[model samples]
Target: MAATIGDRENAQDSVRSRKTNVSESTMFTQLKTREPKAQENSSTRSFVLLALIFIGALVTLGIVYLNFPKLEEHEKQYIRLPRDIEDAKKLGNILSLYKEKYFYQVLGGVFITYIFLQSFAIPGSIFLSILSGFLFPFPLALFLVCLCSATGASFCYLLSYLVGRRLVQKYIPDRVADWQSHVNRHKEHLLNYLIFLRITPFLPNWFINIASPVIDVPLLPFFIGTFVGVAPPSFVAIQAGTTLHQLTSSGDAVSSTSIIILAILAVLSLLPVLFKKKLGAKFD
Candidate 1:
């Protein structure tokens, strides 16, 4: 009788094991079927986004042609950076010719260029910043640069949040995890942290712009911090525009004064964290 009961128990265990295996097998099959479709969809969306950005750039150039044909030479020259003092002088001469008519169009061109370079994560925005100084005065240039930087980064934030976030998790899980923990700790002071992020160059701006939303950063802080944080650097670039012609090298623009200012701002951003820690200690 004991042997008979042991055989019955063994049969029940075998049935349960078979059922578990079948369920797991079905789940694996489902995952295999879904993954390719998901990747294809993600790829399609990324391509569409790139297409739209390039289209916008083309439209901007078209607007310049339709409206300001006489400034054709100016348009082509202004399309990229003035390589040196002579180039700057020639472009300046063209711009001065119809400063009244070209004022709005010049701004439009700069605005579109800024958005294009920033949204696509292109590398030429530093040149654009310098160009802003070359064309517009300090205040106007600063405004345009900050506005475009903040807006462009915000778009990138949204883009990453929607599509790139999963890829980041899949590939750089450890690095993302570490950053997430650090970011989470300062969630309450996100704006300050963002300022610190913008002021310091340890992390590339493109990375911050792409990764911010993925890590659950709010948009307001991102925008405000970007607007305020980039001002110092923008100021340096625009100020250097006053002497764009005299500039022999790009490095000559970011003077020591500006670097020191940025450093001070970076240190100031950390003060809040330090203050909070010391206060907690005193209370304890």
Candidate 2:
């Protein structure tokens, strides 16, 4: 009777194991079936958000253009958003012609356009910076370019904070994690680090703009660092703008001398952080 009881217990245990395996398999199948649908829904949502933002930006550009001072029929052709150095030269020439007559109009237009390009992480702000030099005085051009960069970058930061968390987590999880680690190491001296980043090309500006908020950098420091950090590079671009007629390409804006200057500035920006560390070590 004891042997029979032991046999029944073993048989019951085996049956329970089988049931558990079947339940797990069913769950696995359900997850596999749902994953693709979940991914599709996420993709659809991302597309809609991007579409709406693009349409809104387009309308804003149209309004700015419509409000711009009138130009001759021939000059109107050159008034469009510049894509290349030559396009910039054409736009610069037309703006230089009218800038004196309608100073605020031209200034406001360039200001808005520069911010627009930066906010969207678009590719044409370098040309615009060069154009700013061509159209305005050195001091004014430098200030305007720096302000536009900071404002646009801040806008990008806000957008990423609002809608980009999921996309960044999904698409570039590893990259974001890596940057987050670096950001963590420099959390105390984030402003200096940001300034250094702005001065050097360790990371692309667009990537920095998008990844900054993801890494939790504060907006005030982001703005101040960008405002100050971009000044060195903007100086080069604006100076080059004075000779806009001489430039054959955007590459002309960055010479070996300018690169050396920027490298020095990047190093200088980090000095405060380095000093703080040394002081902490000594005190400790």
Candidate 3:
């Protein structure tokens, strides 16, 4: 009887071991079945994300084009103020009065629109900055202009980071290929290059903002450099707005002195990079 009991116990142990193995094998099979599904889900999510980005860019471009000012032949013909200095003063006065009547509401709209324009690399940002100075007092105008410009620049940076490079390669392949070598060489020092671009008057600010993200400059350094980089020029333009009435001609709005000061500051901004290069050479 004891021998029979031992045999039964051994038989039960063998059965339990077999059950455990079957359970583990079932779990392994389930995981194997799910792996392809998980991969498919991940791929689907990526596609959705890319599609949304494309749609968002299209909407942004549409809005910018819709709101952009119509360019008259006369306005295009003159390099100076689109109109004479006196006419600009009248428009400025009108905008000021409109701002007073609507108070924060109108100002907020203007600020939002300006930010959008800046972010989209719209062509009229220079005019918008001048208009801000014309419509508001120095401190308020400066604050609005700086905030909008920074916000816009940040948007451009994000757009470039996301899709600008691909778009550039697709639409402007020649330009991208030409600049690719130079961009790659200075990729590490992109922030300093961006500052130089911002300070220099030759390239349009809008173009720089749009292009920076494509070249892979990180956002924090870009924002810091842009905020500080744009201030001097913005201040000069805002200060000029103050003397809108004294100007007999469009050229009077920006004097040679203001241009010289801006040029000097722009050159000075490069000093840090130059000094670093000198120190690096000496150490080497």
Point to the candidate with the largest TM-score: 2
TM-score of model 3 vs. true structure = 0.62
Off by over 4 Å in 2: 1-28
What lDDT does model 3 reach? Answer: 0.68
Clash count of each predicted structure: 0, 0, 0
Model 1 ranges off by over 4 Å:
1-27, 72-78, 81-93, 170-174, 276-284
lDDT at position 75, candidate 3: 42
Q: What Cα-based lDDT does every candidate model obtain?
A: 0.77, 0.91, 0.68
Q: Write the per-residue lDDT of candidate 3 for residues 30-127, one digit (tens) a residue.
A: 99999888866755664566568657766765564445344355443332222345655655555565466565654765576677667767655555
Winning model by lDDT: 2
Candidate 1 vs candidate 3: the TM-score winner is 1
Model 1, TM vs. native: 0.80
**lDDT at position 170, candidate 2:** 74
TM-score per candidate: 0.80, 0.88, 0.62
Per-residue alpha-carbon lDDT of model 2 for 193-252, expressed as tens digits?
999999998888888888888877888999999999999999999999999999999999
